[model samples]
Target: MKKKITLLFISFFILASCSNDEDSSIIPVAPVAPTAIHAVLNEGSVDITWTGVEGAGITYNVYRNAVKINKAPLTEAKFTDVLKNTGSFVYTVTANLDGAESTKGVVSEKVILELPKTKTMQSIDIYYDTKYEYAYTYDTSNITKLVSLTIKETNTDLTYKKVTVTNTVVKYTYAGNLITKMSYYSVDDIPRSSVENVYNAQKKMIGRIVKRSDGSINYTVTYKYNEDGTITETNDARDSGVGIYTFGKGNLVKYSITTPMREDEYLAVSNYVFDTKNEPTLNILGFNFFVNNSKNNEISSSTVITLNGELSSTESSKSDNTYNENGYVLTTMKTLKVSSGETLQTRQTVITYY
Candidate 1:
């Protein structure tokens, strides 16, 4: 019995010793650095993605410009950062495991943010034996709202007497940065018209209602967007019209409008061949409903507008534009081909940015 008891005690002691030795040898290891860090530049943001570490219970810390940006360690391997300005930004990510942080993996990128101008003034002067000058002012106190627009027109000859010296004012109201209401007033401070715009959650204009000065609904237009981003607009009083828009490298490439009344079933079409900068032609609204949601008023290289599907060179209107160093339209020469002859028109537009 004593031998047996002693053997049992020895066995128990050996087992306990082995258990303690195994416990003391075990130590927590630091996490490895994140791999395959990538930064994708967007219009006003940057998307960063990386391969996650293999270790369990791993978390990540993201740093921008050498400063930590995330409020807490993130478990996901991807993050999106909204940028305020345009410039170069450096990003680094570090992995953490059990309170131990690994060395950071770095990536650098230059971000060019295309934010809309806050306050803009554009003056266009057209000359063709007669002179017509138009001035437009846009106020964007609220970033998402276009506060007001003032349009002034002057003509040197009364033969082109549609333009007046008095300023026409248009006030805009917004919902979530999308124009919802537009009120127009004549120079005499008389209400001329009011337009109400309705948009879906995607910020695409879905419907528009126009009201004349007498507060009666003059017309209503509804729009539908295809999955490919093309649009079809239908008026309550007329047949539907289709607008086909094409994009290349994230820039508007072409936009064609077709109406039922046209003989060839095409009202107007514009093909945009952009420079390296990918800027489009300037317009009064500073916004292209066909291309994007934002308001960008820049000049284009060339624009051709045809009416009633008339492909004849003698009936189309064409304009060629030149830009200044700041990308503003310096000069525009427009030729209107009439049935009788050709009429040459020149225009100079000056834009001020703030």
Candidate 2:
């Protein structure tokens, strides 16, 4: 019984000794101070700079109006927002260390927006060439009513051809800002081997359609924004198609079509490759209906055609053309080469009535 008592006393003594030593070694840690924070405003952005907290292994939490806007790692010391619209904004920068956040440095600034004048009518010349010019008189005071668009083309025979395209369109306004209206028209005698010269506007073409003639009906286009403030494109076709685009850090990364269209079997799919400066490296296979509009009946494999920001290597086709000093192509040319390696060229002489 004495041995058992002695053993229990020794164990108790050892336990008490360990407990006291642990209590003695406990040391309190001090809180880190927020340091060296500054904010600057540049042309269209806000720049924030700060120093790292000493021995805190801290990250950053940027808040705008109690809502966390961004989170950065311990290594980062700067952040900038390029989209600062005209409004008063509150900012808070908090320090995070070991899953704990420190008190924030708060700042507030107001963005100023200076917009130019709207709702004004002016006369501008829509020039076809040095010789071909027309005066466009726009009166936005009543944008829904008919605004006159009268165009005159100068011919080589020193004569002016006056062609008029008039329509009554309704215009919407945001206070005084003018909203665009959808327009539709067709052109005739575009020189296609096939007699079908009509094209549907809702087909989503990648290039601009210059009116050579007039069409039957006008198609509509509506623009809207995504939840993330990105643009969404939806067409007004009988079978409507939609697409959303995503941009890389600063460059256009990819665009995807969604809803009611197959990715593989769709009418068109384009992949644009770019260099470091976002200039196009190559346009793999962009399609255009302008090939049918050329006066040439046969297309040769060796023919090369260059348009604004685009190039195509197709077969040489004959064309009949009319040209003017103002750079308006009134007519096309005839095709002479059926096989590759022959060059066929034509010119159009334009005459404008001013």
Candidate 3:
């Protein structure tokens, strides 16, 4: 009668142990890259937008041509960049999360710069008596921007015009209606030299500075206005002397330039006669830097160079011009002469509009 009781045995397996300590080897989640980046140009300004990752402690940064242009991190997904130059730019945006920045995405956009034209001068072509030619191009979209100046040593025939820019000079730059800089370009289109204009309180140009590509000053010229409405240009070079400029009715009637010689200083005085009509070159941007642009069309000129107060050489020029519908000079046939009234050459100029 002993108890034949049989006990059933059951076992439970524990998958995890209950503990108060937490996992210390856990890894953090990284920031996600931005997407759908876009850039738009609005009147010389760039507006950049992107889709950013949603997270805490998030920020954004803007890059232009791979250079960080943003002064500080942005919390929004949009940015506006005011451009000071006219050229193509590469734009990209980055996202930051929890003090960490995501690796830069391959997504990037490019924008070609554009500006509005404010003047009417378009292009000009000059044909010299020696078969040399010069063709100046303005911006196709913005005519006020002087694009490039092409010179052909002997290509006025228009037969073998090539795209060789090895012998070109500086391009024009402006600030509003005033042209401020001329950056000389070398064979590779690199600015190897430059000329800058300084203005006074009334926005009158008072000084001109020339510098080499190495940022060294070559020379400086200061312009002083006189009570009699004349201008005195003083050059800061040992070999150079003061230039006396006499203007009449917004035109340079007489100009004298002193240049250094091996033995004595040479003084060249140029006198001009003008017609009572607007000159086409006056409409051109940055053309007055050489003092060739006159409010009225220049019809005749005489130059006499003296060495040590003695006559050295004499020259003269007269232009036979045809006018346009607006009374602007459309074409000019210039006849140049020597001291003995001998005809040296005849040159031609043609202007075209957009």
- Counting clashing residue pairs in each candidate, in order, gives 1, 38, 0
**Candidate ranking (TM-score, best to worst):** 1, 3, 2
lDDT of 2 at 19: 100
> What TM-score would each prediction reach against the true structure?
0.56, 0.27, 0.55
Judging by TM-score against the true structure, name the best candidate.
1
Cα TM-score of candidate 2:
0.27
Q: Model 1, stretches more than 4 Å misplaced?
A: 1-31, 38-47, 84-90, 97-101, 118-179, 183-192, 199-206, 213-215, 224-271, 276-343, 348-354
Residue 16, candidate 2: C-alpha displacement in angstroms: 8.2
Please give the ranking of all candidate structures by lDDT, highest first, separated by commas: 3, 1, 2
User: Number of clashing pairs, model 3?
Assistant: 0
Of 2 and 3, which scores higher on lDDT?
3
Error of 1 at 153 (Å): 5.4
Model 2 spans > 4 angstroms off: 1-36, 42-44, 72-74, 82-86, 106-354
User: What lDDT is reached at residue 9 by model 1?
Assistant: 100
lDDT of 2 by residue, 264-293 (tens): 323222222222321111100111222112
lDDT per residue as tens, model 1, 1-354: 999999999999999999999998887676888888888864345898898888678999988877889898899998888764434577889999877888888564544333223222232334313333333334433222245666665544435645435566788775544567889998777999999887777776788899998889988887777788666666675655666656665556666666676455546666554444423223223244423432222234233455555563333345566654445444545554444555434444433333
C-alpha local distance difference test of each model: 0.61, 0.39, 0.69
